[model samples]
Target: MRICLVASNRFAIREPFAGGLESMTATLARGLAERGHEVTLFAGPGSQVHPEVRLSPLAVVEVSAAAMADRFAPGPEWVADHHAYLALMLSLARTGAEQFDVVHNNSLHHLPVSMAPALAVPVLTTLHTPPLPLLESALALSPDASRFVAVSEWTAAAWRHVVASDVVLNGLDLAAWSPGPGGGPAVWSGRLVAEKAPHLAIDACRAAGVPLVLAGPVQDVDYVEREVVPRLGGEVTYAGHLTGAALARLLQEASVAVVTPAWDEPYGLVAAEAMACGTPVAAFARGGLAQVVSPDSGVLVPPGDVAALAAAVVRAARLDRRAVRAHAEATCGADAMVEGYLARYAELGQRVDAA
Candidate 1:
């Protein structure tokens, strides 16, 4: 089968990945290709090209200087990103059906969802985030334009009022995150931002009497400076942005993984990743983290409750690493995720042939 995957142009799909979305896109492209599907990925610059997966860079259009001169004009980057998606959608509208059996839209951008109906091939869009005004507006315009899949039951519920979505939890390569030597510091992984509340993780770690290592990109400089910077010292250490083996090794060495999200996370990919490494999770029971972290695998406290998180961390570390890994294998392994996607593609493939 010929498959085309549409990814975000804002960030390259290469490692150290910008986030879970990039990682998931790259993984699915390779997975489909390995399963004998002809996979073509439309990604941003510098995306890693696998042997089986073909890469097609998204066309980025430059906004005119005259357009920028308009006082009402939005930021240049926003206009540029909008243009890139518009160009991609227009291209797909022209030639997508002839080139592919189905189109998978993995971008958070509104254009793909809004313009999905124009393309001849079926579109399956995985909702990686909660409904935003822009995306909601797109959905309102063409709610039936694409099939929707949410990363968790929580995310699915978030969109239930807007549009029904199938729940498909994020999965990881468990083998790559194999159990490692533990009894080390606690681990906190993900984008270092206010929403993730790494600062709160620091406070929890301090109270838990556990040394903590924080990893991931500094997405919000102001948040980091105000909250994270002052907390960094004897109890907490910043490991900078890490990916692949470096991240896996760090998770494996940790006794527990701390996740303190101020917002309702759509899906706790980091918790799943940590559990895959046989590391128990100590996370706020918000959104999908509640679904991902089972009692046997980790401990969860109310969101922003540092005292509870601290206690939870100690209890989580006592959990058996093998059991934690077992829960991850049952719930968040790559095989299930890949198979779930393939099933959706197969349904869409049948729809295409019917058309």
Candidate 2:
């Protein structure tokens, strides 16, 4: 089957990933190609091109001076993203049927979901974030425009009021995030924004009497300066945005992985990645992280309880590393994720036949 994958134009679907969405997009594109499916990835600039999959860069439209001069004009970034998805949808509407069997809208944008009905090919959308006004409006406008998949049951429930969805847990490459010997400090990883609350991880590590290493792109400079910079010292350090083996090794050697999300994360890929490395997690029991971190693999405390999280870190660090890896193997395998999508695609095919 020829498959078209749509990812955000915000960041390229490449490492070091901007976040989970890019990483997931890359994984799905590679997984499909490895299984002998013809895959075409529509992603932002600088995405790594694989031998098996074709790369289609999201076209960036140059907004005219007159358009920008308008007081009501949207910001440049918003305009760029809107135009890119809009152009892709129009192209698919025109000639997609001749080229692809299925189109997977893996992006966070509303345009794809809103414009899906115009395309001749079937569109399957994955809900990667919480419900948004634009997206909810799109769903309301065309309730059955595309089949929807949510990354976790929590997220599916969050969107249930807007539209029902199938829950498909995100997966990681267990091979890449292989088992490791754990004896180091606690670690925290993900976008260093206010929502992630990495500073809380620092506080928890301090209370637990364990050192902590924070890694990932600092999305919010103001938040990092205000919260994280003051906390960095001998016991806590920031390892500026690691990728590939560096990030994996950091997770592998950790005594415990700390996750503190102020918002309801749609899915905690960081927790899954840490578990895949045989690293025990101690996270606030929020969103999908609650589902991802099982008893054998880690510990979860009530959200925003730094002292409780600190206790959890100490407890989770003692869990058997082998047991943690086993949980990841059982629940977070990339092959399982690939198969889940294939099942969804098959269902979509059957529906098209019936129609």
Candidate 3:
């Protein structure tokens, strides 16, 4: 199948910016290409061309005036956001959409929904994030849109009231995250934001009498300052943004992995990645964490229960690391992930062609 993928324009695809959404987009595109599907990707300013897939950079426009207005006169914050969304939609529409068998839109923006019906091919949107507003936008704008894929059952459940969408749990490259031998302290990676609850990981580690290594970028400045920074102490070590060898090193040196989300996470990538590394994940049982974490791989506790989370961490410290590694290889590997999507694409493509 010839596929066109639309990625988030917030940052370059190569940039270690956003979590799951971009990573999944890139993963699917590359995996499909490797499987002999013709694939093309539309990326933002920072994304570079890949030999496996054709790349289209969205037309960039200067927004100095709008930036100034947003910075000073903040009447309605959604104004600037909506404006940018409309601009991208218009830019893509100008080029036409008949060039591919399917257009997979990763941007959950409402404006793209307006172009759904007009596009020559079916629009398969993967819902990556969930809040009431995003759910409402998706339902209101794309009510008739078909082939909706949710990254987790929990995410699908959140929007079940809004739209009927299929659930396809996210996948990772197990080979890239293989387990390494012997390390110290627990690791916490992913967005340092309120919803992710990185601070809870630090607190839990302290309570468990273990050191905490903090990584990932600060996604929410205000939330980090208010919740995370204040709690950082000798027990918690801030490792900052990591990539390539640095990221692998952090994962390798960790005794265990921690993911404590304050919100109902659609899918917990941190826990999945840690599991992939053959490391035990001690996370709060909420949203997709329940789906990804198994008894053999890690322990799950009630969300926000610090004592339960801490105890789970201590429990995981005793479990065999080899078993954790084996579980990730079998269940969450890239090969399994790629095969699942290939089947889905074939099924969806047949349905679309028949329609």
Candidate 4:
């Protein structure tokens, strides 16, 4: 099968610094390529090229420093750039669709869905963002989307009216994220943003009387400045953004993991990754966190209940690390995730062909 993958232009697809969606795209493209499918990933020029997965080089229109500085500020430039980006993605998708057996678009930004109806090939889109506007767009796009997949059941439920959605949880490469020596007391790895509740993890760790190493980039600068900064010190140590060996080491060293999201977490990738590293997770029972973390794998507490969350963290710290590792191996491993996706791809691909 010839597959064309559309990814966000925010960052290079292969850049190690690229976040979860980029990694997810890379994993699927490589996995499909290995399975004898011709896979081509359309992304920015900074994206690294893989032998198995061909890269469709696109000239990234970089937002100038001044433009970026005032991007969020009310301006005509923001609207213009947004329109340009949308146009670019649509143009790329239309051109690329002609050469592929099917199109797998990661952009839930409406344009892909808008273009899908005109394409000769079937188009499947995976929803990544939970923002209300995107949800509205997805609802509008559902009739056009051949098969819509949500990373978490929570996400699926969140937009049930917009489309018929299926659950395909986020997966990690166990070989790369396996447990290693130097495991610490506990770990909290995710964006230091309000929605992620990195501060809640800190509070939970404090209440649990455990030391935690908080990692991942500061995606929300204002939120960090207002909420996360004043609370940092002693029990909570900021390890910053970690990738590759450094990230694996951090996960391996943690005795347990904590993911306490203040909002409805669409998918708990951080929790899954921690479990992959043989570390149990203590997360809030909100959104997809409930779906991902089971009693055998980790512990879940009522959302916003700091006391309950603290207790769960303490309980997770005492869980059998081997069991945690085994659960992740069986559930969140790359093979399992890829198998699920491949099945979906095959099913949807056939549906497209039949139609």
Best by TM-score: 2
Instruction: Please give each candidate's TM-score.
Output: 0.98, 0.98, 0.89, 0.88
lDDT of 2 by residue, 39-85 (tens): 99999888984578899867778889998999999999999988899
Please count the clashing residue pairs in each candidate, in the order shown. Answer: 0, 0, 0, 3
Question: How does residue 288 of candidate 2 score in lDDT?
Answer: 83
Which of candidates 1 and 4 reaches a greater TM-score? 1
Model 2, residue 181: what's the lDDT? 99
lDDT of 4 by residue, 178-287 (tens): 87543476888777778888888878788888898888889899998887788788877888877756877887888788888888887878888888888888888888
Q: Identify the runs in model 2 with alpha carbons over 4 angstroms from their true place.
A: none
Task: Report lDDT per candidate.
Answer: 0.88, 0.91, 0.75, 0.75
Candidate 1 lDDT over 36-88, as tens digits, reads 88998888888884688888866666778898899999997787788888888
Q: Which candidate has the highest lDDT of all?
A: 2
- Tens digit of per-residue lDDT, candidate 3, span 171-223: 77676677876367899999888888898898898899988989898889998
Q: Positional deviation of 143 in candidate 3, in angstroms?
A: 2.1
Off by over 4 Å in 1: none
Q: What is the RMSD, in Å, between candidate 4 and the native fold over all Cα?
A: 3.4
